[model samples]
Target: MGSVGTRFPTPAVSITKHPATLPRSPIDDDIDKERVAAAVLPQLLDLTAADLTDNAIWRDSLALTGTFRTFFSRELVANTWRHLCKKSTIQELSITAGSAQILRFGPEACWLQASFSFRTQGTFPSVCSGTLGLVPHGYSWKIWLITTILEQPLGFPDVDKLEPGPADTDHPGCLDCIVIGAGLAGLDLAGRLKSMGLSYMVLEKSVEVGDVWSKNRYDSVKMHTSRDYNQLPGLPKTFTKEDYPYYLGSEDLARGFKSYVKTFGINVTTSTRVDAATYDAASKTWTISAEREGTALQMSARHLVLATGSMGTRPVTPSYMNHGKYQGHAMHSICWKNAKPWKGKRGVVIGSANSAHDIIADMVSEGFTSVTLVQRSKTWVLPASTFGALVDPVFNPDTPSEVSDRILLGNPLPIQRLIAMEGIRACADKIPEYFERLEAQGFKTERYGDLWGILCDREGGHFFDVGSGELIAEGKVKVKSNALPLAYTESGLSFEDGTELDADVIVFATGYKGDMKENAKRILGEEVGENLEEFWQCDQEGEIRGAWRDTGHPALWYTGHGYAHARYYSRFLAMRIKADVEGRPIPQWSGSC
Candidate 1:
């Protein structure tokens, strides 16, 4: 499916205008939310295009149009409503009890928002939940944004039944889904599948559930994002504020994963490595071959979910000229546990991404006198304070994760990118000297960081400043970005600019093999992997390619990256798998109107 267009219209008069510029209205507390909801509900239910503003936005997820789409402008929304009303009959519509309220965003933007439920009658009836945001336009309230999402299919278990139950035993026969890996992505999906009462099992190559975080990562690694956004779907209920801080450390996150697994009573088989997976076209089943505790094992399932991780298992290390000639101890960032062993030794970290910055800071804290960070290219840097400011409004301690998730994920990726760039510029304007100082010290930076490109494309060309930026500015940690490394010179690294830095220890903070398709090929054989579409990057429709939905192959799917992606998209993925197992007709995008 293709998106409408990349350009977003900017109107001369917008609902988002500051209150100081617009005419003063009644105070927020004095507004009658019920009256406003009553006045606007009828026009919305009637699907009247005149009730929407010129630049209104309608984000739908298999609710109105039976597809994931974002319609911009009154004309597009009107066309979509015309198309929807022609195909399906609207059976019922009503406001959700106690859902109406006046929502205030920042100092100026105010809207009357409410949640509503509706049903569409057809061969396959769908129950959907939606939120509408209306603003005062001239004499009447007009909708500026409307979001609709599929709650569940008719007669299926409630999607909100996400509580822990007794430990479910592994099925002796064919199961509904078999998930690979027990990391956050896998565990989150498994939890949702359990909530839907689907038969499934999670296989992990490690002996323990959270070993990937506790053992595989660097010792000082902590979540770059805040704690509220990092928790899995149902893990927050078992946590207290004192249990973990704002930013969870690697070990803390690992423990949280263990708690989540125990709380959900999820079926997990540890120490099991999957050797191969093959799909049977005739039977429509996937047979997985593996080894558990040095013994051969095989399992069959109707569907397969590859949730190993966003980044592949192998660490990426580029070969240097005469790398073997250097006698200094060298390793990738993954193998470097802490800086205690390399205390008082001269250390050089090759890479300017998150891991490199983190390792530099760790070495400084551990009393390493001489530490140098080599930057291969320009990196987008944002202060941790700026990052917190961007997310704290939505994903904060005061707000519920589910509520915050909807607001954040509701915007399409293309629109989100534009919004993020604007936010970054606003924050950068407040602290121009921050980037100035780093540039003065020979570190290059991107003016307006491409959050989407860094996240969805390169994945490692950006760094969120925690404390390393300060250390670099203060000259406590040296930086070398003028030249690339030419080769290793027995005791240190030699650069292209005829400069040599002596080092006793060298660490490559370079990232991992991040392509999911390549990882799939290595595990599922070339024949099965080649048939799958590209993964991770965004498609033309502004949706992520080949994740949480179809992968162009029957009996196969992929869960995407990060805690937010895992938490929000897991339920949708589970619903899709259930529909597949039961032979229900799944909705498809019918292209933009």
Candidate 2:
């Protein structure tokens, strides 16, 4: 696929790049031929009409809230989206046990809504639990520079969605600033900056917004924090018919962001691909470049926000081959947008991480004859049921001011910290069964970070608190199957012990490695003035505040970190950048670049 920018004299890594990509016909408006169809929610659940009624109760994750008009706008947008995809087939991205198998590409009024209830992996946060649904528009406008045919019609190995960013010197696409990956973080940053009258653009590598939700189609995906605590600053809100808030489905989330981007008229070049970038310290500008629809071009931007969050891609095949290959429909959850490919395929999901676990559970619900998650090692697996419908009374958002006077609402950092600590401690005393069952299942544990973490988690596991330390030793989540994955032949997998099992598909849920390209590294280099990779040694956490390095450059800011409060975190980083540009002092997370 063709991408923007100039070629460096000599690049550090040989990035396998794609050239100009293919394009699709703009969807024609046929309101007469097409109309928003009434939605028949997925049949995965035998829900009574009562189940369909709103039940978004319990406290929020973040303290932020939005106007009903905003969220209702999205619902209306979904209505319009329903009009768009009346004939589009609906598929379930994921379907976990005791929860709904989310329907993807469902008909609504203006958009197609993918609705379901998902739980975060391993995270036992008291605040960010519960089930919800969402409706995201279909095919707004995409100028794809990258595409994969592996799962075409439904998905590609990678369909690089183009997004527009800051104005450029010659190429009109580049502008003052460009934010990539318009998920929770990108939209938040873009909207906030636009509100401040900044001339900027957002470049999403997907065909749409909500890449975080779009990318990981695995079942049981949800925020690790409470919904209230994890909203984008300027979006609308839909309260539970009762009172509290909760996590919305992937499509619902995409709708929330789509509204933010559209309502603000954020300049986004969806489906455009950025090839390479070079920093001109002389100009204090980045010579950004990209390719779209078979054309090559370059542009200049004062700043670049690499809000592409943590964990870029999940592989369909494991990095290491245990033996020869056998194939039925082996693919990663990232590549599986619909169930058509795996409808009746028997599957073996390698690795026991959140993605793998979620995929297996979803496939089973989709009527995949049989699914087994091949464990290289067991982990601190916290089922969704534990956190599903969980209600924590300690989080200050729901606490009345009179009772929370000593803890929340503009309290000093010390008081807030004390309350945070006290509430977590109480949770620790209250919830142990979540972990008790895991240990009993023989899933050895590693104290997440340390002892304090155990108490902080109120329970134990990976996604709970979002940080890793040796602090909580309540038996850290352990990987018991450190042994290699066995080999798969024509019909099955064979282990060294001669243990063999039949298989139709073999999926490697082995997570993603950090991959920031030339432009990203060049930005990193300015900090050391020379060695970029060397600097990574000092900062093992990789990108700070997602991708914002502590370099003196303010133009280089990254927001999406794919952690608990990813949407909020991106907003936080963007807020800081907004402050920096407006001559306000920027807060320091870690001064060392």
Candidate 3:
């Protein structure tokens, strides 16, 4: 293995740095961000790994190598650089004009961050973009973190620059792909496919593109995540903060989705519900059966994508004994629109998650005299402000969402979990009473390690407290975790501990069955679905199972979850499908998981 300098001659690279505009803390004032960036660029280009700190992290996604990899520690980074230098040559490198700045999270924590464009000369010349973070170590700065992502192949379609056009409606043969569910995931993939000149169509079951958000959710619902993290790829330039708030409401998000569809000119068929789909291995095609306005329709595609979303469409409501005997007004959280109808009525909300907490808070605000939250299990609660603070370094208003996403998705799941745990602990230390109050009220809180585990395992079972924690702590809202609901009485519910609660309305805030395997089984039949790998949880390799990768069936794919997952993975999924359609070798990494 050869070092970077020995493997390739140094090219004439243009170095440009922009002044940092962020308000600097006293500690950051001593550090010159441009000087640090200029000093670190040459060391990185020369692969002088000794300049990196012992715990530095180097994340490369198909740039230095043809795979996703994270090199931890100075030794690991040096070895990988030497090994890859033998196979690939750095042809050209330059700092992205006006991309260097000092990012300050606090007085004591700040770094010089910059972006660069580079090209790798090998069998396949590839263009890439990377971000570097330099932190002050001792008296000087050291490379603390670097992330590189493949921009495009030498002659491949520049997906970013491709203009939105109408989908291929006149194509008479089987299309390349048919994406189900015209939500964020489906719309994003459609945009990518269209840019790649792939014949694809998006089918939405709802009457409109964003009915899932605007019509289905409860009133007063707002996104827990910030708007930057949730924006889809190829978001229209015209859609600005005026279109959607920092924390989007349901109607605002719906409007944004509508604008995205219109701006991209994506081909979407609305009110189309897919009933069944079967794949033929002989021809490697999928025949889909669907209904639109009671009209049966059939379509054929070489590839079928299940973008119906990770959150299962089927809402799960527990069956209590004698559910129909004494129901005043029983409904699932899905049916909860607003508390206006049940105002001044005694309300009992079952389940202990985001939805349950939000519903309880809404009920209290709506002047409900009595509202009780029945916690069946422990919940990991974190204040919304705390969560925002923890992620502010990456997902702040100043940082571009695309850059923040790469920094986030570059890290493997385990690494992300470990980093997140530190942030959670730090936030908890600042606000210890948040958890103490909830626990004291018998609300059963899991403050640590449970956040990511619950998200991966159940995608629920946790609540980011917006205002509900205070309500519960102050006794404005009641709590019932001592016993489980045993049966329904004429007025309300009876618990196993011989306790009975009187209520006029009972809302089961229990979440949906967010299992992709079960969803596949329902739509694609038992044979294909049962054989597919499990979804959601991290596999042995820490990669999410059965999503954005090959499922058991070659023609089938699942790509849906959060907005960020869709935005980041859609590019890769589209590239994979493009390679398959063009009979090109699909890029694969042989590195260790």
Candidate 3 Cα errors over 4 Å, as ranges? 1-59, 64-90, 93-116, 131-146, 161-172, 235-239, 278-284, 316-327, 390-399, 432-451, 591-593
Q: Give the best candidate by lDDT.
A: 1
TM-scores of all candidate predictions against the true structure: 0.87, 0.54, 0.81
Q: Estimate, for each residue in 1-593, the C-alpha lDDT of model 2 and write its tens digit.
A: 11222321122221111111112222334331112211323321222222221211111111111000111122322332233122222233232233322221112112122212222211111111122332222522111110000111111111112133332224344355777667666766766566545567777667776655745565355454455444454423322213433555566566656655655566677776777666676665777667767677566766777766534442435643444466555566566565446677776667655555445555665777766555665354333333332323422245422222111222212222233333334444445664564445444443222222222221222434221111112323222243455566667676656666666776676665444333455434443323332111111111121233332343565454432334333333444444444454332212110
72-155 in candidate 1: lDDT tens per residue? 777778677667755656557677777778754334445677877778775558897787777777777887667778888887
Q: Which runs of model 1 end up more than 4 angstroms from their true locations?
A: 1-57, 65-67, 72-74, 91-116, 133-144, 170-172, 235-239
lDDT string for model 3 (314-363, tens) is 68998889887786999999889999998899999999887888899889
Answer with 1 or 2, whichever has the higher TM-score. 1
- Count of clashing pairs, candidate 1: 0
In model 1, what is the error at residue 169, expressed in angstroms? 2.1
Q: Model 3: number of clashes?
A: 0
RMSD after Cα superposition, model 2: 22.4
